[model samples]
Target: MCERNHPMKCFLATLLVAICGLFLHPATAAEDPAALLRAADRWRVSDDSLQVETRVQVLGRDGAVEKERLYTVFVQSGHRSLVLMRSPAEAGQRVLMLGDDFWLLMPGSQRPLRITPLQKLLGDASTGDIATLSWAEDYAGTLVGEESCEGQPCWHLQLRATRAGVSYQRIELWLGKARREPLRAELYVQSDKLAKQARFVLDRPEAPTTVAEMVLRDELGTHKETRVRYLSRTPKRVPEAWMNPMFLARNPPLE
Candidate 1:
C-alpha cells in the first residue's frame, strides 16, 4: 500500500509547481510590453530643425522597377518644412512647408499653389502622408503584448486615431526590446485591410534619442517606397508665420 501511494504523492507535487509557473509567466510577460512602449514614447529629439535626404523607388504590380527619385527635406518644428527634388530630371522643383500647410512651386509657374486640406488627403505626386508631421497628436497608443520581430524579442502596440478625419483607423507597432526603437508598423484602414507598412532599421543612436534609418512603403498600387536618412539636427526657434498656408506660398526661404 505504501509503495503504491508514493507515485501519487510525487504526481501531486509536480502538478502544483506547473500551475504556479503558468500564473507567473503571464505576469512576467505583461511588464515588458508596457515598459517598451513607455521607453519609445519618452525618446524625443530636442532639436526643432530636422534635415533629411531620401531616395524614393516605385515598383510596378509585377514587381518590376518603375522610377526613382532623390529628395531633400528640411523641417523646423511648428514653423515650416521644405522638400525639394534632387534627382531624376525635375531637380529644382520645391515644396514649401508652413506648419500643417504645404505649397508646391512648379518649375515654370511663378506662383506657389497653396495645398488645401482636401488636397492634402488626395494622392498628389509631391504631397502625401509623408509630408504630414502631426502623428504624435493625431494618434493614441496602448501596449498590447510581446511578440518576436525578425527573431528578436519585441513589444507589440496598438495605435488608434483620436480624430475621425485621420487617414488610418488602426496601426500596429512592433518595437525592439534592446534597441528601444520601432521595428515594424502596419497601418490599417476602416475595413481592416493593411494600407501601408513601415519598417525602421539601422538605428543611429544619439544617446538619449535614436533616429530611425527609415523605409516607408505604401502597399497600394502606387508602389512607392521612401527611404529617409537623417542629415542634420538643430534646436532653433521657428517663426510662427511659417505655419500659415498663405505665408508659405508668399515667402519661401531660399537655400
Candidate 2:
C-alpha cells in the first residue's frame, strides 16, 4: 500500500499543483492583466510593419451577402495604419490612422476628411477593428475570470480605453491560455451597452496565434455579421511618410 507521505505521492502532488498553476494567473494577480495584454500583443504584429490584403464581406440579418470589399493594408509601428481600397468603385479611397487621428480620402476629394475609429466600415466591424493596433498601448486591462471559449481554456479580461477617441469604451477579451492568442472579444459602448462581439478565426489548431480571419456580429436588433479574411501576410517596407494624413492627398505609388 502507498503511504500518504511517500516520495511518489509527494511528487504527484507537486506536479498537480504545477499543472493547475498554468491555468491560474500566470503572473501575479495584480499584473496579470497588463502582462497578458502584452503577451497577446507580441503575437499580433511582432514586427515593424505588416503588409497584408484583406477580403471583407458583409452579411444581412437573414444571412444573405450584402456587400464585399478588398483592401491592401499597411500596418506600421506606433499604432499607425493606411488602408487602400482595391474595389473598383472605391479603388482610390484611402483611410489613414495615426495614433488617435483618423482620416479618409475619397477619390475626387482634394482634402482628407476627418473620421472616427468607431465608425462602422461594414456590417458590425468598425474602422478600428480592421486596423492592427497595439491593445496594450490603448487600454488598461483587468483579469475578470477564466472561461471556456470554443472548447478551450481562456483568460477572460476586461479592458477599458485609457485614451480618448478610441473605438470602444470597453472590451471583454478572451485569450487562449497556452498561446496567448485572442479567441473572442466583446466590444461595449458607454454604460455597459454591448455594441458588438468578435471572434478570432484560425486556419488550424496548430497555426500561429495571428488571426487568419475575424467574424464580427452586432449585439443589437439586426444581428448583422461581417467577415474579414486575411488574404496574405508578408514582410514589406513601408515609408514613414505614408502614415501621415497628408500622404493621402499625395497618393504615393506603391512599389
Compose the digit string of candidate 2's lDDT tens values, residues 1-255: 447769898888888888788668554443468889998876565567888788899987688889998888888877788888888867687888888888888876768899999777666767787775578888999888777888988888899999866788899999988787888899898677998889888767666757778888888766878998888877776877787677658664344
Screening candidate 1 with a backbone cut-off below 3 angstroms (N, C-alpha, C), the clashing residue pairs are none
Task: Kindly report which residue stretches of model 2 are placed more than 4 angstroms away from their true locations once superposed.
Answer: 1-31, 61-64, 207-209, 252-255
Candidate 1 TM-score, true structure as reference = 0.63
Clashing pairs in 2: none
Off by over 4 Å in 1: 1-38, 41-46, 59-66, 96-102, 107-129, 132-135, 163-167, 190-192, 204-212, 222-226, 231-241, 251-253
lDDT of 1 by residue, 1-255 (tens): 235659987788789888887786653544544455556643433344655555555555565556666666665665456666677476556676554455777665567786632232212123434443444555677767668887889877788876654457788988776666777889787788887787765444345355544566766656466554444444544455544545544543434
Please give the range of 10 consecutive residues that has the lowest summed lDDT in model 2.
Answer: 22-31
Root-mean-square deviation of each candidate, in angstroms? 7.4, 5.9
Per-candidate total of colliding backbone pairs:
0, 0
lDDT score, candidate 2, position 189:
83
Per-model CA lDDT versus the true structure: 0.59, 0.80
| RMSD from true fold, candidate 1 | 7.4
